[model samples]
Target chain A: MQLEVKPKGHTVFVYIKGEIDLQETERLRQEVDRYIDHHGMDHLVFDLTQVNFIDSSGVGGIIGRYRKMKDIGGKMSIVGAKPTVEKVLIFSGIQKIIPLYQTEKDRIKAEK
Target chain B: MNVNEKDFRVKNQIRLTIQSRAENVAFVRACTAAFASQMDYTLEEIDEIRLAVSEAVSNSIIHGYKNDPYSQVELYITLWENGGIEIVVEDHGCGIADLKQAMEPTFSTEPGRMGLGFAFMQSFMDQVEVKSRVGQGTTVILKRKVRQPVESKN
Candidate 1:
């Protein structure tokens, strides 16, 4: 999987491309944490439209990141998860804590 | 696990032995999906099998092998003529002592893990049978039935 970070105002958007399964979740957590630490960016958006698949390990990675985000007194949101991927996320019960949006625009709209 | 005589009639079968590494999880997922696709299963069913297969392989790598990367995970897949499938993922590593607690949702021996592996296997598939011997290994058997293909949702 490939991970890229974009900073817009106070929020950081993470564009993930590829499958987020057991093999790649550790790298995901480490890289995203690095971005958050190095830039000190708070509000985070995970752009998952390009993610092909995700399993429990990926869910755990997201939940682990949420805990870090909470500890830092910040917010995190998920954007553009396909139907299958969305179902896995829901089954893991992470959607109850992290708001999921169809797009970054939708998240911005929800904020207002 | 109840024995069904019909389930013994395997239309197709496959066996694989992979290294106990994280990367092999995706390999197992892809292989299972490809093998199951030969039948009349839908795309969603294929994805479900893929997810369940991934979870089982991940558990072996993380909990069973303890991330040793040198161990082995064997997979036995049987496709029934009636559009049903049985997948067995096995690992010879540290085993679970408390099977009941291990299957509980949100219960994990390792921290930072969701502990939803068994749950996902049980949820996505029709049946999930777990057999483990502490200090010997663990085996996960997943079965699903997709006899009739529904209207394609394209």
Candidate 2:
């Protein structure tokens, strides 16, 4: 998996590509956590457009990050989830907790 | 009494064994997804199968083998003549003590785990049956029927 981080004002946009499964969840968790800790961003946005596959472990990693942000009075949102990835998120009930947006522009606009 | 073996036909079958490791999880999924592609499954179906297979293999690597690199995980895929697929993921590691409790959602023995592996398998596939014996091994069987393309009217 590849992760790209871009800081836009108070939010950190994390663009993830490739498959997110048990193999990549630990690295993803560590990277996101480290970035959040260092940047002190108030909002975390995940761009999953390029992500093709995700399993329960991947969902767990996302939930863990969401919890981490929430504990710090911050928010996290997910955008551009493929249909297959969206189904797993919905089935795992992550969609209800984290807002799902179609694009980064929509996510930023919603937060405004 | 002799049974006619010719009466039963096997369409396609494959067996794979890999060391119990996190990296091999994706490999298992990719192999199964590629095999299922021959059935003309939609992208959605393929994703579901991949997810289910990943969960099963992850369970073996994490819970079953407990990160033991020496242990091996076996995967079997069989395509039936009726356009159905059967997948079996087996591991000769620590098995579940209570199958009932293990199948329940949100019942994880490890921290930071959702314990939804079986749930995803059940939700995605038509049938999911688990057989295990503590100190022996565990085998997860998943079956799904491929949707036939709609016939066009001439």
Which of the numbered candidates is closest to the native, going by highest lDDT?
1
- Local accuracy of candidate 2 as per-residue lDDT tens digits, A4-110: 98998888999999999887999999999998888787899999999999898999999999999998999999999988899899999888899998887897698
DockQ of predictions, in order shown: 0.93, 0.86
Pairs that collide, model 2? none
For model 1, name the residue pairs that clash. Answer: none
Q: Please write out the lDDT profile of model 1 over residues A70-105, one tens digit for every residue.
A: 989999999999999999999988889999998878
TM-score of each: 0.94, 0.93
Q: At residue B14, give the lDDT of candidate 1.
A: 97
* Index of the highest-TM-score prediction: 1
The residue-by-residue lDDT of candidate 1 on B48-154, one tens digit each, is: 99999999999999999999999999999998765688999999999999999999999998999999999999999999999999999999999998757333222
Off by over 4 Å in 2: B1-8, B149-154
